[model samples]
Every structure is written in structure tokens, then in C-alpha cells.
Target chain A: MTGDEACAEGALAAGCKFFGGYPITPATEIAEHIAKRLPQVGGVFIQMEDEIAAMASVLGASWAGVKSMTATSGPGFSLMLENIGLGICTETPCVVVNVQRAGPSTGLPTLGAQSDMMQARWGSHGHYEIIALSPSSPQEIFYQTITAFNLSEMYRLPVLIMTDEIIGHMSERVVIPEASEIQLFNRIKPEEKSMPYWPYIPGADGVSPMAVAGEGYRFHITGLTHDEKGYPVMSAEAHVHMVERITEKIKRNISHIIDTEGYYLEDAEIVVVSYGVSSRTSLSAVYEARSMGIKAGLLRLKTVWPFPEAILRTLASRVKGFVTVEINLGQIHLEVQRCVGGNVPTFFVGHAGGTIIPPEHVLSVLKDAF
Target chain B: MSIQSDQSDQQTHPLDDLLRKDRIPHIWCPGCGIGTAFSACLYAIKSSKLDLDHVSMVSGIGCSGRGAGYINLDSFHTTHGRAIPFATGLKLANPDLTVVVFSGDGDLFAIGGNHFIHAARRNMDLTVICVNNLNYGMTGGQVAATTPHLAKTTTTPAGNPETPFNLPLLAYASGATYVARWTILHTRDLTESIGEAIQKKGFSFIEVLAPCPVNYGRRNKLKPLDVLRIYQEKSIIKHFASPSELHLDLEKGITLGKFVDQDKPTWLDMYYKTTRKKS
Candidate 1:
């Protein structure tokens, strides 16, 4: 199966009943596949006007008590930021897949880039924690789409699957397990009926049970700084309480949310940190470094935001030097440096939009570090 | 008579009480028609007979977009110009619910113009109430797509250099099943039109010509009452007008009334039928 097909199947397995999006390059295949598949499974597929409307439609579908998703590229991702912020504020559970393409402004719609890593975190204005996953292969995208839906439902936040054009368009054999083999997470619903249910009240797990519209539970939700009752109360205290709760819900649950793959970290002198398509290249570099008898290891980040900072710190302490590989010009390297805390020397191997960092470049960085 | 008696007997209308009281010192200076237009919307919602719990009001960023947050339903204060698509998804997922989109001239017809046309073209089961204030009131009175020709606004200090759009005509052409235009002065008629639009099954667009007292009103040297008087005198019902006659004159403002009434299979109806047949 192709990566796009894998993503669509993953959404179906996760019980996504609604898919609304406008087709853009690299990501168009996801929308096309879902459009064909959704109706067969008693679901809906709506082709909206633009990326802005596409994102808004997904949010609406989610509120109607269905798992909803949309797919897009860099330009479409830029258009979706406003409504993505609304999803965060409203605590609507939905999945957004950015099959990233090269761009400052439509630089290369057909080519691949990992330029949206930072944007996925900060694109939506205001302070909030976002969950973003990076998949290295078609199989990973399929599995990660399920994880994205689970995380979105559990945390009541928008989950982003950030795939570059290369991975999104790549064809590979993917094994989709039977429905009985896959685990699905549904939104926690309130048990008591006609009771005053506060949509923003978090339980012990830092997740609030969701109540859909027409469920007969009266609840208010606002974009402004809101209290537990979901009513907007503008004050320093309310702002502090609301912002802290929103951020802390994800922050406190980092242990359960963060996922990373570490290779050859024991007694390593140098480490290579990368994610998404870059991880594949970085893995190749690690293999080359090992053959050259270099004490080098690799850390592949699966979950990008709520970034694997603590694990990076532990790896940084064990290694003498670190190298960051990415398809963009030194974006995640800053985060690597912040985590390393100047204790170890860090090097960057990066390419701008429409270019991919070769494995040799990463190997050269490992050699230079040694 | 059933609708009339229901309208009269209802005391403490839930929809009316849900509106913002502080803004009740409304920004529209006295005589501006927006208040009358807004009241019509409230009346229409009250008469829809749909469960408030099953209704979701969505608005884009504008003076009118603020209407979503002020309403008592499950409201969404979304981004600027994206209400149509948002409402589209909401209605598709839960066809039983009533979805209403409220947006201003600039927000709906300008930035959100693509969404508006496509939503109409798809014939989605949603109610879209576009309040044409002639200018972008929230952004300090810039000329909008619905601004009349030679109209004085902040952006068009002398006169609007570009041609304006006839929103109901555009919507009617785009395949909206029910399309209507009414000025704020025609309160009872506008309310009745809104009620009928709400009762209609497919995509319904009601373009209300609301007055902006602080912006367009002051610039045109017209009070809200003068704006209402202009609408009352110049406007003609679409059914009453000749097909060859243009709705608007450059000197005198355009006529307003229900322009299109057709039956088309809505997006939701088609979606369900297709899914059910497959099952």
C-alpha cells in the first residue's frame, strides 16, 4: 500500500466517520483515498472550498460526535492555523495531516521539505501544547494515524501527522491488521445525564470527558480565557488558571505522550538526532559511522511536539557531541541545543526548502564531531 | 396561523434572552437598521421549532461574527470568513442539527467569498445569514464586495471605484435553493422571510441590508432612520419586479425580496442516501 492509502486505512480503523478537505499536492492522495473509503464505511467526505474551510469543517464534524480529519500541505497548513487554534481552545478532538511540501510561499508544491516543524508548534496564536507525530515510513504513517486519533481523543486537542512530500507520496508494502487486532479510543463521555457538565474539567489523567452537542448536557465553550464551566471570565486570575490548565494538561502527561526510538546509545561518543524522513538518512549515517568504528548512536523522534526533550537531555549527557539532521535549515537544531545545554558540542546538517539532506552529510558531521 | 399563534404565545423567548445585553447599548447608532435585521434573525430562530440543544451557531471574525458568541446555543467564534465550511461539516456529521452561519459583508463576501459560493453550489443543508453593512465596520469602514457603487466609505473617501456585488443574485446563481434579500426597514417582512428560509430544507441565504450608523451612516450624512426610509421607498419585491428590469439604480438603492425558490437535493440528503444505499 502507498503511504497515503495507509493513512486513510488508519483513519478508518480509528473510526473516523468524517473527512473534509481540499486537495493539495502530496496530500491530495490522502483526501482522494478517504473520499472513496468513507462512504463505504457509513461516513462522510466533503470537499470544501479551501484549506481554511477544510480545517473548519473537520472541527465541525468532530463536534457532531464523530472522529474527523483533514489533509493538506505547507500552504494549506498555513491557512489552517486560525481554526487549529479554535480547535485547541474549544478542546475539539480531530486529526490534521500535513503532507509537508517545500514553501516559504509555494516554493515547490510537488517536492518534499520538513519546514513546518516549528509552524506546527507555534502557527496558532496563543500559548497551548500541540501533539505532532513524524512518521519515517508508510507503515509508521498508518500506525501513527491511529495514535494521532487516540491522542486527540484522550487529550481533546488537535493531533498533527507531519509527513514530508517524500514519505507522503512514497509507495511501499503496508500491513493493515484486522479490526480485532487494532485498539480504538473513543472520547470519554459523561456518565450522568442532565447534570451540569463542565467541558474543561480535567480528571486525574488531565483529560476532561467530552459531551457532544444535542446530548442534553448544557455546557459552554469559549475561545477566551475560560473557567472550568467553559464560560469566558476575563481577569488575570481566570487567564492564569485557564492557560495553566490548558498547557499543563499536556505537559503533565508527557510521559504517556512522548515516543522515541533510540539506537546504539550506550557509551556513545557522538549522537545523531532526527525525525520523519530525515531519520531514515540519519539511520544510514549511524550505520556508516558504526562500520567506520566510530562511537556514534541515533535518536529517532516519533512524537515531535512535547518534544522528547528529557530523553534528548539523557542522551546528551551520555554523548560527547551531537548532530541534528533535517530537511529544513536548522529549525529543530535550536531545540537540540536548548536540551543539550552547552554541555556537548552540537553540529547541524540541514537543507533548505525542496532539498534533502544526504546521509553522507550526516556521516560527515559525525566524523567532524569525532 | 399555527406559526402566528406560536410566535404570540411564547413569552421569555430563549433566543432573545441569549443575545448580549451590554452590547444592547449597541454600537449601531440610533436609526441604523442592523438592530431591526438582528431582531428578525432572533424571531426566525425562535420560530424554527428546532431544539436549541441541536443547533450550533457559527460566526467568522467581524462585527456580525460576534453574533455566535452572543447566542445561547453551542456557538463557535471561528476565524474570519470560514463559517460556511465549518457549518458544512457540522451539518454533515449530525444531519439532525440546525447549523446557522452569521457573517458580515467583508468577512463572508470578501475574504470568505470562495466558501460562500462553494457552499451554495453544493447546496449544503445550512442557513447562512449575511448582514451587508456595506463596509467593514470592525476594520474602520473599508469598502467591501457588497458596497454599492459611488458609496462613500473610509477606503472609498470620494466614491467606491470598484463595482459592488448583488449577493442574493450571486447566491441564487450559485445554486442556493432558497435565496432572499431584505433591508432592515422591512422588519416584519424580513422576519417572515427569515422564518421561511429557516423552514426550507437545503442551502438558504438571507442577505440583510443592515445600516452601519457610525461608519457608513455618518459618512453618507444619513441617520439610521434615513437609511430605513431609503430602503422602504426604493425596495421592491422580486416577484413583483419585471425580469428585464434591473434590481438597483445608481441613484436610488436596489429592491429587496425573496429572489429564488427551488427544490434541490441537499448535500446532507445526498450524503445519507448514498451511504444508506451502499449499506
Candidate 2:
């Protein structure tokens, strides 16, 4: 199956009952596949007027007690930023899949690029944390989409599945896990029906139990800086408390939220760090460096946000140097450098991005860093 | 009778059960007419016989957007101008729920105009209550899409150059199943219309012309009473009238009534019919 088709299946398997989307290249297939499949499983699929409405619809459906999702490329994702903030403030659980094509503005709609990594982390105009996953292949996208939904429900925020055109369009043999094998984490629900429900009061996990629309919880939700009761409180102090609750939830759960794969890091002198499609390229370069009798290893980032700072810092102390490869000019490389914090030398191998960085180029960077 | 009875000092207000009373002492200005239109909506919900537990309200940002926050049901005050799409999602996801979009003209028409036309064109099963106060009342009376031509506003200091939308005409053009216009002065009629709209299938639009006494009325030199007087004297009940004739002209006549009422298959109806094989 193609990565886009696998993404739709992943959403379906994760119990996403609603899909709101618009047609955007490299991501349209995800919408199309879900549109055909959702109704058969008693779900609803709506093609909204635009990406903004598509994102708004996803939040609305999620509040109606259904797992919901939307898919877009770079341009459409830009249009979705405002409501993504709404989802964050209101703690709405949904998944947004950005099948990244190259763009400052529609640069290469049909081609692949990992240019949207920084945008995913900080695109929404406010202080908030985000959960984003980068998958290198069709099979990984399938699993990561389900993981995205699980994290969204567990954390009560929109999770992003950031894939590129290459991975989104690539066809591969994806394993279809049985329903019993998939571990689904639903949003915690408030237990006390008779008592007054304060929607924003955090549990031990820092996530409040969600109450859906028409559930007799009679809860109020807004995009405003609100109190625990969900009433809009226009004060700087209230704003602090609200932002802290949402941001702290992800920060406190960093152990469970982050994942990384290290290949041959034991006693390696040079470490190559990359994610998504670039990780595949960097891995091949690491193998080539090994064949040439160089002590080089690759660290593949599976979850990009929350940055895996600790792992990178630990690796930085042990390795002689670090080489970061990505399709973007230097998005994740900056994070790696920040984590390394001048403990060791850090080198970058990337461009403004339309095509992939070749393994040979990564090898050169690895050789130079070594 | 219900309106007069509502004024009596009853032990508990009829809408107390449906109100978030803790959030009372609302932010509406002293002479603002949103309170009347909002009460009528609550009364309609009470009378509509739709299960209150299965009813949800959504609003965009504005003074009227606060309606959703005050309601005690499952309510959402979403981002500016996106309430229709949000309510569209809510209704489609849970087809059994009676979803209502309660917001201001600036929210529903200016910023959210595309969503309004598209939802209406699709005939989505939603009751949209637009509190049209002629300007952006919340932001100190800036010009709005529904602000009358030649009307003074903060943004239109001299006067508005743009001709205001004839709301019923727009609703009719966009294929709303039920479209009506009423002022807060016509409380009984407004309540009745909202109740009827709630029970009606497919897209229903109610444009409530309320006075923004602080921002709009102060600029236009129309006091609260003066705006109410115009609503009383200039209003003409014209049911089934051509929406094109239903423009607002305070000195001449304000055409008000149910302008369009038809039974059309809702979006969900078509979705199921097109996708499901008939037994």
C-alpha cells in the first residue's frame, strides 16, 4: 500500500470515526481512501470548503465524542494554524497529517521535502508544545498515524504526522495488525456525572478528562484563556495557568512521548542524526562510513517534537562529532546543535530542499566531522 | 402570554436549568438587545421538544458568540468565523444531535461568510441564529458586512460605503431550507420563529436585528428606545415575500417574517442515500 492509503487505514484502525479534509496534493489520497472506507465502518467523512474549515470540522467532530482527523500539505497546513491553536486551548484530541511538499509558497506541490518540521513545532501563534512524528516509509507512516491518534487522545491535543511527498507517495508492503493487536488509548472521561464538572482540572497525568457534546455533561469549551470551569478569564495570571497546564502535560510525559532508534552507537566516534526520509539516507551513509573503516553511527529520530534532548545530549558527550542531515535548510539540525550545546562539534548537511540529500553528501559530512 | 409570564418573579426562571448561572452577569452592554434574542433561543430550545442532552450550541468570537458560553448544554465557543463549519462537523458526526450556531453578523457574514454560504448550500441540518446589530459591537462599533450603507462606524468614520447584505436574500440565494428575520422588539414572533426553525429540517437561518445601543446606536444617534421604536413602527410582517424586497430601511419599512420555508434533503440525508444500498 502507498503511505497515504496506509495512513487512512491507520486512522481507521485507531477508531477515527470522522475525517474532515480538502484536496491537497500528496495528501489527497489519504482523504480519498478514508472517504471510501469511513462510511463502510459507520464513520463520517466530510470534504469541507477549505483547509481551515477542514481543521475546524475535525475539532468539532472530536468534541462530539468521535476520534477525528484531517490531512493537508504545507499550504493547507498554514491555513490550519489558527484552529490548531483552538484545539490546543480547548484540549481537543485529533490528528493532523501534513504530507509535506516543498514550499515557501507552493514551491513543489508534487515533490518531496521535509521543510515543514519547524512549522509543525511553532506554526501556531502562541506559546504551546506540540507532538509531531516523522515516518520514513509507507509502513512507518501506518504505525505512526495510529501512534499519533493514541498520543492525541492520551495528551488531549492535536498530534501531527509529518511525512514528506516521497514517503506519502511511496508504495510498500505494510503489515495490517489485527484489531486485537493494536493498543488504543481513549481519552479519559469524567466519572462523576452528578457533580459539577470542571473541564480543565488536570489529573495526575496533567490531562483533564474529556466530555463530549450531547453527553449531558453540559460543559463549556472555548478558545479563550479560560479557567478550570471553562469560563473565559481575561487576565495575564489566568493565561499563565492555562498555558502551563497544556504545556506541562507534554513536558511531564516526555519519557513516554519520545522515541529514537540508534544504529551502531556503541563506541562510535562520529554520530549522524536525522529523521523521516533523511534518516534513511543518513543510515546508508553510516553504513558506507563503516565499510570505509570509519567509526560512524546513525541516530534515527522517530518522534521529532520534545526533541529527544536528553538522548542527544548523552550521545554528544560520548561521540567525537555529530552530522545532522535533513531535506530542509537546517530545521532539526538546530535542535541537535542546541542539545549538543558545544560539548562536541556539530556539522549540517542539507539544502533549501526540493530533492533528497544524497547518501554520498551525508558521507562527506560524516567524513569531515570525523 | 409566555413572554409576559416570564417577567413575573417566578421562584426559579424557566431557563435556569438551561443556563450556566455562575457565568451570569454577562458582558452585554446595558442597552444591548442580545439578551432578548438569546432568551428567545433558550425558550425555543425548551419548546422545540428536541432532547436537550442531545443538543449542542457553537459560536464564533463576538458579543453574540458569548451565547454558547452561557448555555448549559454542550457548548463550544470556537475561533472567529468558523462556527458554521464546527457545527457542521458536530451535526454530521452525531446526526442525532440538534446543533445550533449562535453568533454575530460580523462572525457569521464577514469572517465566516464562506462557511455560511457553503453550509446553507449543502442544506446542513443546523439552526443558525445571527444577532445582527449593524456593526462590530464588541470592538467599539467598527464597520461590519451587515452595517447599513451610509451608517457611521469607527472604521467608516464618514459613513459606510458598502451596501449591507439583505440577509434573508442571501440565505435564500444560498438555498437555506428556512430563512426568517426578526428584531428583538418583536420578541413573541422571534421566539416563535426560532422554535419553528428548531423543529424544521435542513438549514435554518434567523437574522435577529438587535440594537447595539452603546457602539452602533450611540454613533447613529439612536438610543435604545429609539431603535425599539423603529422596530415597532417601521416593521412590516411579510411572510413568503420575495427576499429581494426585504432590505432594511428604518425610515420606510423593515420587512420581517419567514421569507423562505421549504423541505430539502439535508446533507446527512444525501450522504446516507448516496452511500448506503437500499434494502
Candidate achieving the largest DockQ:
2
Share of real contacts kept by model 1?
A: 0.68
- For model 1, the stretches where C-alpha displacement exceeds 4 angstroms are A194-198, A218-240, A353-356, B1-32, B240-253, B272-279
Listed per model, the TM-scores of chain A against the true chain A are: 0.98, 0.99
- Indicate the residue-level lDDT of A281 in model 1: 87
Candidate 2 docking classification: high
Q: Please state the Cα-based DockQ of model 2 relative to the true two-chain complex.
A: 0.81
Chain B: TM-scores of all predictions: 0.87, 0.95
Model 2 chain B: worst 10 consecutive residues (lDDT sum): B1-10
Q: Which stretches in model 2 have alpha-carbon errors above 4 Å?
A: A192-194, B1-11
lDDT of 2 by residue, A1-370 (tens): 9999999999999999999999999899999999999999999999999999999999999999899999999999999999999999999999999999998998899998999999999999999999999999888998999999999999999999999998899899999988999999999999966458889999999999988888788889999999999999999999999999999999999999999899999979999999999999999999999999899998999999978999998888888999889998898999998999988998999987778889999998777764
Q: Estimate the TM-score of every prediction.
A: 0.92, 0.97
Which candidate achieves the best TM-score against the true structure?
2
Q: What lDDT would each prediction earn against the true structure?
A: 0.84, 0.93
